[model samples]
Structure formats: C-alpha cells, structure tokens
Target chain A: MPSDVSAPVSNGKPGRLRRLIAARAEGEALRKGNLLVLAVLLLVAVVALLPFYWMLSSSLRMPDQMFANPVQWIPNPINWASYPEAWGAQNFGRYFFNSSVVAVLITLGNLLFCSLAAYSLTKFRFRGRHLSFMLILSTMMLPLEITMVPLFLIVNSFGWTNSYQGLVVPFLVEGFGVFLMRQYMLSIPTDVIEAARIDGASELRIFWMIVMPLCKPALVALAIFTFREAWDLYIWPLVIITDDALRTLPLGISLFMSGYGTAWDQVMAIAVLGTLPMALLFFFLQRAFIQGIAGTGLK
Target chain B: MSPVSSSRSARPGPASSGPKTPGRRPWLTPGSKQTAFAWAILLPALLILAIFRFLPMLEAFYLSFTDYDLISPPRWVGLQNFIDLTQDPLFLKSVQVSLIYVSCSVIPVIPLSLGLAILFNRALLARNFLRSAIFMPVVMPAVVMAVVWTFMYQQDGVMNTILGWVGIDPVPWLRSSSTALWSVIMIGIWRAVPYYMVIFLAGLQAIPRDYYDAAKIDGAGSWATFRYITLPLLKPTMLLVVVMNVIVAMKVFAVPMIMTGGGPGDATRVLPLFIYQTAFEFFDMGKASAMSVVMFAILMAFAFIQVRLFTRKEEQ
Candidate 1:
C-alpha cells in the first residue's frame, strides 16, 4: 500500500479500503463545495444583469403591457415600434453625432497630449519636471463639479457657449489620463531610451516611433476610459448647451424623458440606444477595459 | 537650466551625443537641449490645463468672494457669499443630504465589494463569464441607469413586484421624502459595488499566492487565511477604493438630477445638484462658487490622505 503522510497507516486490506473511501469522500466534498460557490456566484450575476434584461425587455414590450400585473419577465409579441417612434420623436441622430464627435476628439486628444506629456515626465530629467507632474496630479482633486462655475464663465468669455469647443476643449486633457500614462511609462526600461538616444534618434522621433508602440496596452486602456467618460458627459453639456441641435445623447434622452414621461416604452428605447454604443465598446475592448480599471487601483 | 545641467552631469552616460562647443555657457549643454525638447512636448497639455483647470480653479476662489451674476460684472463682496451660505437653509439641507448620500453609499460598499471580489477571486466554473456578467452594470451609462431605475421604481413597477415576491408592500420610492434618498442610495450602491469589486479583485490577485499556500499548510481555515493574508495586503487597495468611492458618491449629480431633481422637498439634493441650481438656475454664481469651494475642500481632505498614502508607498 502507498504510504500517506497525513493519514494513519495500517498493514491490512481493510485499512487500504478505508483510506480509499476517505479520499473519495474528500474529493466529493470539494466538488460539492465548488458547485455551491458556482451556484451562489451565478445568483449574484443574475441579479447584476437583471436590470439590463429589464431595460431590453421593457424596450420591446407594447406600451400598454409595460406595467402588466405580476411583471412579464419576457415581453409577448415583442414590439419594435418604440425604437422607430422614439428615434423620430427626438433629434437623436444629431445627438448621436454630437456625442461621437465630442467623445472621439476627447479620446484622441488625451491619447496624443497625455502620451507626449507622460513621455516627457518619465524619460527626461529637467528642472520643474516633478513640479509639473505634481501640478497635473493636483488637478484630479478639482473635478468638473467644483470648477464648472468658473469654467462656464471662462467658456462664456471665450464666446464658446453653445459651441462644440465649449464641450470638448475644457476636457481635452484630463489629469487622470496623464497620471495613468505616467504610471505605465514608469515601468518602461530607461536603457532602451538611452540606447535610442545613442543612435542619434531625436527625442520626438523616439517618443513617436519606439515609446508609443510599446505603450499600446496602457494607451488602449486610456482610450477606452476617456471615450466612455466623454460619451457619458451629461452635466457639462447640460450647463453649456442651450442649443438643442448641439445637445449630446444624454441631454437628448433627458429631454425626451421629461417631455414624453408617460411613454415608458419609448423612454426605454432611447435608454437602450444610448447604452448600446458603450456596451459594444466595452464588449470589444473587454480586456483593455478591465486592465485599465484594475491598473488604477493597483498602482 | 543650471539645475538641469548639473543633474545631467551627475549621470554617468548619455552626455556623449553632442559636441562640446567652445566658449558656450555651462547651461547650454546637451541636457539643456533635452530640457527644451521636454518642455516643447509638454507645452500643449500645460497650456490647456492652465486655461481650463488652474485658471478656473483660481477664478472659483476669487468669484466666491464676490457677487457675480452673468449680466453685471463681478462686484467684490468679501466673505458675503460664504457668510450667506452658512445661514442658508437650503444649502444646509443640501449639505445634510449629500453627507447622508456619501456616507450611506460609501460605507456598505467596502464590505459588499470586497466580499464580491473574494467570491469572484475563487476558482469556479465559468468564472470569467460570471465576472463579465456582473461587470455589465459598469458599462451602462449613468443617464440610462437613472432613467431605467426611475421606470423600475414606480409604485407598481418591477422593484415593487420583486418586493412582493418577498411579501413586502409596494413602497413609493422616489415620491416620498423619507425613502427618496434611500432609493438614490440603492442605485449608488448598485452601480458602485460592481466597479469597486473589480478593484478589489485586482487587489486580491496581487497578493502573493505563497501566503495563502503557507496558510493552508498550517491548517488555517479560509476565514483565517482571508483575515490575515488578504486584509493586510489589501490595505492600499482598500484605501484607494474608499477614497475613490467617496469622491464619486459626493459627485453624484446625473442620477439624482435626472430622477428626482432633488425633489420631495430637497431630500436628494446633493451638493453638486444644488451647486448647479445655484449657479445656472438662479444665476447666483458667487454663492455657487462658494458652495463649490466648500465641496472642493471636502474632496481635498480625502485626496490629501490618498496622496500621502501613495507617496509613502512609493518611498518604501
């Protein structure tokens, strides 16, 4: 018989049989425990996704059946009219265009400007380098909520109110993006940069050709982060945009809800449409998204 | 420039690229060129921030001390807006409501998110699928969440129907002053818990696996392993989550703005919402700036601690 360190050994057939049974029981218990954990986690995940399911299902339900008694978990004869009606009711096309422009510009601007600044902060030794980095870091404390008033006055002074620049310029470069990029850049080997310098590569050429490509993971993460934040911009647009034509998707959806409050089906439809772009973005870049969020906390 | 040249000279290599020009100033070395290049690249970001963030921040402080409405020029009224805010009932109510929101939403999130993180950290069937499922809420935009939750919170709506399954009465969620803040609080927790859970999972994964294995060899139970091996190492992440979550909760604007509009007698009137109304709706820019300064101070207090913790970790 094979010797077991933890289990008592006895020189007999009965002892070997008993050991086999005990090991089998332990294995059975472990499998059952795993099943229990899986079951519990599945339940939590269901609850987490329940709202999304409700949003989609409610969007497909007929107007009258939305508040049906006992709650129809699934819509019967799924109504597709809400989408078209909702889209027709508002200038949703304009709103989607506005959101896309603002978010894309903001994302691209962050990727470019933040990477340039991060490269400077990480790769170069200069006077006030630390001070400049700290200055940028301190801005994280001054979110749009606190600075929006003066920011509004400043935008108004520039004659930017009711303009796209009003929405996009203030948020073109974020403190968090710089900080995220800086943290990621710190991990890069200075030896490689030094070697590039020895090869007589210009500073800008090194940043553009060598450094930027190596930082793809962080850049991808920052891109998605900035895009989502820009797309989700509500308060800034609400404050600056008085022109209905320039309103973003969130602003448009809010107006739609208040103006047509009782049209729950249509409201859900707008909600779904508004959420779809972000959901798709997240789905495609799930790994980068998770890594980006995890990076912030870990760092 | 002298400091830049000296710092560069302190380094052993990379000073060999450019020729040493005769009779040149000490500061006009290769290092100076590098410094100039760095500043050139950094100029755009610094300029943008100067215009948008730093300038406005300074302006907010200045405007808080003046009486400014959009039409007339800002009239210097030292301490008037601050004094008025101290005695304003609605402002006080907003402060109270915001405190309630921040505290209620932040406190429970720590454990709930940490617990969820621990669960998701375990090896299980389709674990990635489950984590992704739970993470779906974070993808939903805040505006959509507010609108959908408003639909679900109606008296005869899905929330009430779910409560019925548990033998509870249909509660008026957003209509009543008493329950309105709590309703907002529920949504805050729902959205936050998943986001922070991901953070906590990251923290969990960071802990060296050898510690847990050592604990198991010592016959330690799961609870003991978690208490000793998990919690201590996760201190930094816990601090990060707390500070981030509190800042986020304090800035809870879109959800309440869209759902209740700080309604049912200012029950859900968070600070940002009140600041918005005070500035734009009432055109009381000075008073709103004062409120914003107060909010900034509160957020800075939390941020100060975070900076301290992170800097200390870096030093170690």
Candidate 2:
C-alpha cells in the first residue's frame, strides 16, 4: 500500500477496492500515454521525411509516371535514367563542380581564419579586444536581406560580380563562425597554452600544434556549418551570378525549374542531387551537427 | 568577459617564456607586444568583415538617402523616398504581409517545437533514429525545400490527396490569395520547428535530472512539474528561439519567391522580396534602400529589446 504513491495502493486506506482499480487504471493509462507520444512523434517524422522520400521516388520515376493519380509513393521499376539525363539536361555537372569548389574553399578558409581569430581573442588580453569582439558580434544582427543590395554593389564595384570572388569571399569569415569558435575555445584551459609558451613554442606553432588538435570536434562542427551555408548560397549568387558558368547549385536548380518547368522528373533529380551533399554531411557528422547546434543554443 | 580575469588565467608566466634571449628580449613579455600579436592574428578576418559586412551595412544607411541605380552618379533625395513610401500601397501591403507572415510562422512554431523537444527528451524507443528523421527537414537545402513543397501544394497534389482521404475537399494551397501567405508560413514551420526542437532538447538536457527527481518525491503531477520546472528553466533557450524565428521569418524570401512568386496579387510579397524587386528588378535603388532602412529599424528594435531583457534577467 505504501509502495505506490501515484495511485495510493490501499491496504486499509479508504476506498480500498477503488484504490486497487485506480492503480490498474493508472498502469493502463501510462501505457496509453507512451503509445500516444510514440504515435505523435511517428507522425511528425513521417511528415518531415515524406518530402525527401517523395523527391527520391520521383527522381527514379519516368516522366509519365510522376504526375500519375493516386500519387506514386514508390517507382515501380525504379528507373535510373533520370540521374544521367538530368545531369546532361543542363550544365549540372559544371554546377556541381562549381558549388563543391566554392563550398570547400569557404569552409577551409573559415576553419583556418576563424580559429586563429577566436583563439587569439579568447587567450590574449589586448587593447580593444573587447571592442573588436563587440564589432564582430554586432554584424550578426544585420540580416543579409537588408544588406543584400549594398553588398551586391560593393562586390560589383570590385568587379567581382559573376566570379568566384563574388560567391566565396563575402562569406569567408562569418561572425557566427568567429563566435562559435571563441565560445568553444573558452573551454580550453589556458594552462596548456602557457606550458607551450614556456617550452619556447612560437605562437603560431602553439596554435597549429596544440590548440588546433584539441579543437577538432569544434572544428568539425564549424566546418560542417560553414560548408552548409556556403552550399546554400542562393540569394547572393542569384543577385550577382548572371553567368551560366558560375552558377552554384541553388541558382542552377532554380534556373532548371524555370527553364524546364514541366520536367518534374528532372527537377526532382536535381533537387535530390542538391540535397545529398548536405544530407550526407549530416549523416557522417551527425554528432558534430547536433553538437554545433546545441553549442549555439547553450552558450 | 572582463580583462582582469582573462589576463590572469591566460597570460603565460612571461618571465619564464622569454628565457630564450638576453637584454634584447626581456624576461617578461610586455602587454603591448601581446596586443600587437593579437591584432596581427585577428587582422585578416577583421579586414574581410570590415570590407564585406560592416561597410555594406553602413552603405545601406548612406545609400538610402541617395537616388543611385549603379548607372548614374548619386543624387541626394533626402527623405523623399521615405515620404513617398507612406503613400505607396504596395510597400504598405508588403509591411502588413511581412508582419503577418512573421507572426504566423513564429507563434505556432514556438509551442510546437518546445513540445516536441520535451517529448523526445525522455528515454524513449528509437530515440536517435526518430530524432534524425524529424531533423531531416532542417538539413534539406532551402531551394530544394521550396521546390518540393511546391510539388506537394499543387491543387491535385499530395496535400490535397491526403486531405481527400480524410473526407475533406481539396484546398488550393499556393494558388489562392488568401492561402498563399499561410501556405508559405506552413512550410516555414515545417522546416523551422525541428531545428528549434533541437535547441530546446539541448536546453531540456541541460536541466539537472535531480530537479525532476525532487518533484517526483513531492508527488507533483506532470503538468505541474513542467509548468513550474521546465518552462521557467527553458527561458533563455525560449528567448533565443523566439528572437531567431522572428528574424528568420522577417527575411523569408526564397520560399515565397519560388512557391508563390508573391502571386495571387501580392499575398506573399514580404518586405525583403519587395526590397529585392525595387533594387534589382525595377532599378529603383533609392526606394529599395528606404524600404531596407525601415526593415532594419524594426529588426534592430526587436533585437535591442530582447538583448536588454536578457541582460536584465541575468542581473537579477
């Protein structure tokens, strides 16, 4: 009777019969609650994944079978022709290559430059260091949408429009990247850095040898975040890159949609193609991905 | 964040670290030398941000006053653009539409995401797999998301097909003026909810399990526990999610642009989209910059208030 506090098991407690019934009912109710929670989560997961499933299934379907009634959830024969056809239908190969180079370079640049800056800011007590960090923090508040036209003009003035400079340089060292790195670096004990210094290691050597190695998890998270943002460069590329040669994947996909409005099979193929790099990155780096997000939330 | 504490812990025993040289390099490194080194290391990134981000942000302010369209030299119009916007119906409509869109996307997104995060925070079956499944939407490319949603929202599309099975008539999601803004908001929620859920899940995990154990000993109901314990403790994360969602919703461009093209007569023509058309498509940089100024002011006010509120909470 004293064991279960939830339903108040009744040895001599008032309403003994009712108490026993209530405990049994509470057990049943608990089971039902678990089932209900699972059901709700299942529904949400389905909704989240349905689009990916639909896009992949459509990418494998023939053109005629795409718009068929009853909504083809799975392609019957799983036609693989759309992959090549969509690749060749437009300059998707070029687009893929361009996006890859831009994304990777920007990611590498952020890793090297942001980590250097963050490490220095967190480790050193210097003049205007606080001011410098504050200046960087302030930029995060200004939406790229508000600054888009002016940023475009700035790039245009430098003769960077329609070039890699336009696509990559404007985003190379992000405020958010700097912030993330600095937050992560704050956890690193200064004792280690001091020991390195006493051992006559140069500052650069200390950073490269000691600090960078210890910061691998944070670096992986930053690399993935930076890569995803660079890969998703849509509005800026759309504004600046009017040339077919420099079109990134998102721009390329939009152009594909506009140019081939009726080609759902090909459109879905390109959509799936555009999503896989990011999706695969998420798959391999799921831990860092979640950690990156959680880090931003927590600190 | 104060200099004293950071310097105390971070500064090497400069006297020992400088043992390599005689009088030329003293036994203790000077503070100015460290400042110089910090500036040198930080210079490249600072230079990039100064030229790209900070400069452009200022340019948005200065350019708002001038009538320049990349062709002719600047002509100062000095508040005329702002004055004209007061009478411009389309600009006015965009402000309304943007507010509605932002509000709609954020209000429902907060509760839904937090609730989902709470559900998954427990020790449950298939936890990681279900999390990855739910989080799949946030990782999908925005362009890809908009395109696929366009597919599902077609009049006879999957949305209606599913609705039909529920004994409901097909609803034209993207085609009608009344539903276009809401449809865009729905997709915004679809993508945003899971992302914020992860943030809330992190917040929930951070709460010590001992608090919940204490509540159990006190015989508190689940609702009482959550209301008093979980909700208050999640305040910081909640504030972040709310502010971020608001800002993101204000800048909703590619989705409505691709989904509806602000179609059915400006139903989804949000402020950012309007600014785009004014600056690029129509080549009216003055008016566009003015619109951006208005948008910036509103965002700044929201951000300023939230930050102040957060700092006040910390002080208490």
Candidate 3:
C-alpha cells in the first residue's frame, strides 16, 4: 500500500480510480446539460414555429374540420383550394403587390440615403459635427406619438393622404439609419479614405468603390432590417393610406378583420401569407440579422 | 465633431489653406466642401426627420393649447385640453392601464431575459439555432403576432387546446374585459423577450471566463458562482437593458394597437391608443395632441430618472 501510494504521488496527480470517476462524471454531466439545452431549444423552436405552422395547417384544413372536437395538428386531406380561396376572397394578389412596392421602395431609399449620410458623418471632418450628430440621436428618443399630430397635418396639408407619396415620402429617411451608419462608419480606418484620395479618387468614387464594398456586411444587415421593418409596418400606413388598393399587408389584415369579420380560417390564411415575405427574408439572411442585433447591443 | 467646428469657421476659401500636405488636403477638400458633401448626403434624412419627426413634435406642443378640429381652423384654448384630460375618466383609466402594462411587461423582461441568456450561454449544443428561434418573434411584425395570438386565445384555439389537456376549461382571452390587459401583457412579453434575450446574450458573451474559474476553485456551487460572479458583472448591461426596455415600453403602440385595439370595455386601452383614437377616430386633434404632450412629459420624466440611475450606478 505504501509502495502504491508513493507510485501515484510521484506523478503529482490524483489516483487512477479518482481521476477515472471524475472524468466519467464530468462527461456525463456535460452530455446531460447539452441534451437538456437542446431539448429546451427544440421546445422553443416548436413554439416559435407553431403559430406559423398552425396558420398554414389551419389554412389547409377543410372549413368543417377546423372546429373538430379533438384539436387537429395535421389535416388528413389538405385543402389546397383554401390558398386560392383566401387569395381571391381578400384580393391578396393586389395587396401583395402594393406591399412589395412600398417595402422595396423604402428599402432602396433607406439604403441609399442612410449609407451616404453615414459615410459623410463618419469619414469627413465638418462643423457642428458633434451637435449635428447629437441632434439626430436626440430625435430617436422622442416618442413618435408626439409627432403624430403634426405629421398628420403635414401629410394632410401636402394632400399625401390616400397616395403612394404619402405612404413613402415621409419615411424615405430615418434618424436611426443615420445613427447606425455613423457608428459603423466610425469603425472603418481613416487610412482607407486617405489611400483612396492618394489614388486621385473623388469622394464619391472612394465611397462607391472602396468604402461601400468593404461595408457590405453592415449594409446587408441594414438592408435586411429595413426590409423587415417596411414589410410589417401598420400604424402609419393605416393612418395615411385609406384607399383599399393602396393598403399594405398589415392594413389588409385589419381591413379583412373589420370588413368581412374575424373568420379565423380566412384571417389565419392572410396572416400566414403576410408572414411569408418576412419569414423567407429571415431564413435567407439570418446571419446578417443576428450580427445586426448583436451589434445593436453594443450601442 | 471637434474638428468640424474649428475647421469650418476659420476658413474663407479652403483650396489654398487646404493644408500643404496632400494627406490633409483631401480631408480639408475646399471650403469644408467634403463636410458640405457629407451634409448633402444627409440632406434627405434631415429633411424628412425635421418635417415628420421634429416638426410634428413641435406641432404636438402647439396643438395641446388649442381646440383644433380636423376640419375647421383651430380655436386657442390654453390649458383647457390638459385641464379636461385631468378630469376625464377614460383618460384616467387609460393611464392606469398603461402603468399596469408597463410595470408588468417591463419588470419581468429584464430578469427573465438575463436568466435565458445565462441558460443559452451555459448550453453547449444547438446554441445558434436556439438563439435564432427565440429571436424570430422579435423580427416578426407585431400585427401578425396580434392576428396569430388572437387565434390562439380563441375558445377552440391551440392555447385552449393545450389547457384542455390539463382539464382546464376554455378561458376568455382577449374578449374578457377583466383578463384583456393580462392577455395583452402576455403577448407583450412573448413578442419582446427575444429582443432583451439577444441583448443579454451579447452581454453574457462579453464576461470573461476566468472569473468563473476563480470562483470554482473557492468551492462555489453553480448558483453561488452565478451570484458572486455573473450578477455583479451583469449590472452595467442590466442597467442599459432596463432603461431601454422602460423607454420602449412607455411608448408601446403596435402591440396593444393590433392585439386588443384598446378594447374589451377599454380594459387594454393605454395612453398612445387613447391619443390615436382621439385624433383619428374622433377627429379631435387638439385633445389628441394634449394627451400626447401629457404622455411625453410622463415618458421624459421616466427616461430622465432612468438615465440618472444608470449614471449613478456607473459612478459607483
């Protein structure tokens, strides 16, 4: 026993028996912990997707089967016709086009204006730069509620009501966009700008050629954000756009509810359809979305 | 910012004084012309924000003083809107509803988010997928959430279906005046938690692992380690999260707007929705604007205190 104890002591380590058990226990615990997290994540994923899943599943179920005594997770005979029915019933095609136009235009405008402004604020030395930046930042803290009255009056005064210009022009630019761009631009090295200038590149050329290409990550992230925001927009669009033809997706959903009544099957159909563009966008550009969010946490 | 002020006022023509060195010349670029160009790029954004965001804010202040109808010219009625708002019963109810909504929704989101962040941080596998799934709702449009949730809360919906498995009878969700606020509160939490969770996750990632190792050597259990290590380190992140959450919660419009539309006997009706209704539905811009001013003051006060508290925490 003395010889064995001395043998293990020479290694400056735990006994083989003790080491083995500790290693086994740690492995077991790690496995268990990972399994538990995965399970919880699976549950969360299910919950996150459930509404969308149910919306699709319900949309496909025969109207009679929807209210069946036992809740139906799977519709045995999927009603493919419901899609067309919903489309026709709500004039979804027109609404989809309207939403597409508005969302796309907003995205384009934001990308161009926001990037340019961000470039200037970040790259160039200007007068009242701090004050200007602060003024822009301060605008973000002011509640949109306070601005509603004057915005309405302004839009009304401009006869923008019920028109595309009314829906589009007021939101063509954003303070948040400027603020975000500025932060991102500040991170780019001053050497790059100087290098471009040394090569006889104009400011516009430098921005378009060097800076814009390098800032792809931020721009892509901002684009995804802008697209999502524009797609889901409701309140302002509802306030300004009164024409049924001009109504965006969210507005269309509300109109469907109030005008035709809360037919769950139909509403879910519209709801599911409305979520598709954003859901698809999310799936495609999820990487950029996460990066954008994580970056936001820093500020 | 410092460079901008000094550079602009001191210059008459920037071409000659544009710095002898080629490196500095590009920066000076004729009459702070580069700055002018920068401002030019920023023009559309400024113009829009000025007219829509800032101008309206000023107009809101102005409207608070008048009895302006949507159709007719305004008649000045100083303090009347504020005075009437004080006595108004619906406005009072709206205020109560808003306070309850903010308190219930904003309070749980912070710790719950932190708890979730820790959970995600400790979990080894499927971290990315889990994080993404949880945050999916945050990016989803609020109106769609309202529509989907409206379905879930229906008598025969999935929520009821799940509840029935435990033998609970169907509960009135958005329909019940008594339960409507709570129902909206739940929706608010569901829609919002992911945002805070993402923020907290970032915060959690920033905390170095060595501290945990040191605590473990001291024979601290998991909870003890968390208490001694994680919570204190998380204070800065927590303060920022809470301040942001409170400010955003105070101005919440979309959730309540689409979910309850401030309905079921005005139970879920909050200040923003009240102002919206007064302006759009009732065509009383004056009253709407007045309500907006009152809400802004309340929000500003809350924000001021939140900032002071955060700075105080930092100093300590």
Top candidate, metric DockQ:
1
The better-scoring model by TM-score among 1 and 3 is 1
Best by lDDT: 1
Report the lDDT tens digits of candidate 1 across residue range B1-316. Answer: 2565555555654332222333221222247789899899998999999999999999999999999888999999999999998999999999999989998999999999898888776545676778888888889999999999999999889999999999999999999999999999998898888889887887776665678768978999988987778987888788879888988898889999999999988999999999999999999999999999999988887678677976786576
User: For residues B186-235, what per-residue lDDT tens digits would candidate 2 score against the true structure?
Assistant: 98999999889887887777666678879979999999999889988888
Order of candidates by lDDT, top first? 1, 2, 3
Model 2 residue B92 CA deviation in Å: 1.0
Q: How well is candidate 2 docked (DockQ)?
A: 0.31
Q: Write the per-residue lDDT of candidate 2 for residues A1-299, one digit (tens) a residue.
A: 00111111112334435434544666877667767898999999999999998888888887887767977787987888888887898888889999999999999999998998987777776667777888887777787899998899899999999999888898888887887788667666666877788999987898899989888867876887778778877778889998998898888888888777678888888899999988998898776676665555655
Model 1, residue A151: C-alpha shift (Å): 0.3
Two-chain DockQ for model 1 = 0.33
Write down the lDDT of every candidate, Cα atoms only: 0.84, 0.81, 0.74
Q: Kindly report which residue stretches of model 2 are placed more than 4 angstroms away from their true locations once superposed.
A: A1-31, B1-30, B308-316
- TM-score for each prediction? 0.90, 0.89, 0.87
What TM-score should be assigned to candidate 1? 0.90
